[model samples]
Target: MGITIFEDSYRHKGLRRKLIEELRRKGIRDERVLNAFDKVPRHLFMDSSFVEFAYQDKAFPIAAGQTISQPYTVAFMTELLNIKPLDKVFEVGTGSGYQTAILSELGAKVYTIERQKDLFQSCQHLLKMLGYNPLYFFGDGYLGKPSYAPYDKIIVTAGAPEIPKDLIAQLAIGGRMVIPIGTSDLQVMTTLDRISPTQVDIHEHGNFVFVPMLKGTNNR
Candidate 1:
């Protein structure tokens, strides 16, 4: 995938502004998250066919049976992470790279992994085109990126059956992780605050439905 071209027209900006307002009303009070949302053109992360629906506060299908997460969900999760400048972030399930772009915009060094080879390649190209430089990996997300251990923050975009011990182990002391855990039908948005080497605090926010966190990579 070489350089690609696309236009972010004034109309798109206007719709995104309206989306920002919608997110604010729905309890997404983080201004930095809102600003990141305002900057990244969601349409560019979507297929050309779904471009018109890009700014809507809704989830839409992307490649490899994954869906670009709803804007509200993304904002909610980001707000929970409490990102700071230069915080090392490891992201599981880099679907479409929209959330990855958000993390980058918020000044985090993002390391993202995708199980689907197609999404991994396409998102890598698109984020690069948009000038976001997160390190990208095409592999199993369940294993987490251990080489980049001691991450200041970690976010899992997919719903896990339970908390992944590997990811928890990679977090830096006093680091935070936002993940959704439950069955395939639904999940509870959970956050883990690593207090010490053996002690961690777990908290649940609310319920959300996400694509299941799967093991291994899919060539398709």
Candidate 2:
């Protein structure tokens, strides 16, 4: 893969710091999550046209029909996952690789899937250039990654019509899965904690908007 060069200057760092403060004021109390945001250069993950607003706590369009999730949403989901160092995290969408970098920054061994071939390839290159080493695959997010089962935490970054049973099955007992389930326009942020082999504790956070989680891979 060819290296994509982007500069991260002091101005960008200042902007990120401000963004973190904004997130904190918005009730995101996880220091680790904030720290991850502090480290990753959000502008570097965005297109040149959108880079100026990268730290604005909003979503921006990416290569696929997907958006790089808003900073608040990303922080909220990461906080929900309660990530720990070396924890195995299964991520459902690898859009722009921004969230993937955050997971890496929080010290998780991330295995992420993206169905859009263009996004999968570009994000893989960008993550590698940024020195993130997450295992990335181009496949269906609904199917999850069974070859590396029993993840410590699973995070789905797209809106799903229903909770994917296959993904739930891939969660380790005692593991947590954060997903957005509802219609295409809006979704309730829900978390499933697997307490036993067949029992899961469900909790719903607020609603958020995301691209629909589609089936199968876009090999083109």
Candidate 3:
């Protein structure tokens, strides 16, 4: 795989500012989340072919049948997590690493996993080039990173048929998780706040679309 070259120019920053305003208008009130959108160069995470639409509030296809999620979706989910600086975050479906960069920007120590090897490697390289350091792993997202259990927060980027029990088990007491759950065609954005050792408060936010979260790793 050749190195994907990207430039973060002044024009890109201006577009990002506009994107932030659009997100605010869409009801994303978290200041930190908005600041992250301002800091990360969204265009750097997209293929050069779709660079023009990078700052748009829309999803774009990436490698391995995945997508860089719409900006509002990212902000909505990130806001649900209510991330605190230096919080330990476990992320499923690293995809384009754009969301991972946002988590890192908000001062979360993110541990992200990806099942597709191509996306895993490419996203790792791009994130490094952009200087956003988050621990990366290639594995099945259905099985949350057990070795690093008790995460303060967890975010799943893909749409799941149901919430994975292992993910809930991995959350620390009083931890939070943001995931999209429902069918492959459409999903409801849900937030699970672990209130006790055995209790979690689940809240449904709204509807969104995302790639299906597959069960196992794709070595191909």
Each prediction's number of clashing residue pairs: 0, 0, 0
Shift of residue 57 alpha carbon in model 2, Å: 1.1
Tens digits of per-residue lDDT for model 1 on 1-220? 3333468889999999999999999999989999999999999998889988999999999988899999999999999999999999999999999999999999999999999988888888788888999999989887898888989999999999999999999999999999999999999999999999999999999999999999989998
**Model 3 regions lying over 4 Å from their true place:** 1-4
Give the distance in Å from residue 174's predicted Cα in candidate 2 to where it truly belongs.
0.5
Best by lDDT: 1
**Ranking of models by lDDT:** 1, 2, 3
Model 1 TM-score is 0.97
lDDT of 3 by residue, 1-220 (tens): 3443566788999999999999999999999899999999999888899999999999999998788999999999999999999999999999989999999999999999999999998888788888889999999999999999899999999999999999999999989999999999999999999999888999999999999999989987
What is each predicted model's overall lDDT from 0 to 1? 0.94, 0.93, 0.93
Worst 10 residues of 3 by lDDT: 1-10
Clash pairs detected, candidate 3: none
Query: Scored by Cα lDDT, where does model 1 land?
Result: 0.94
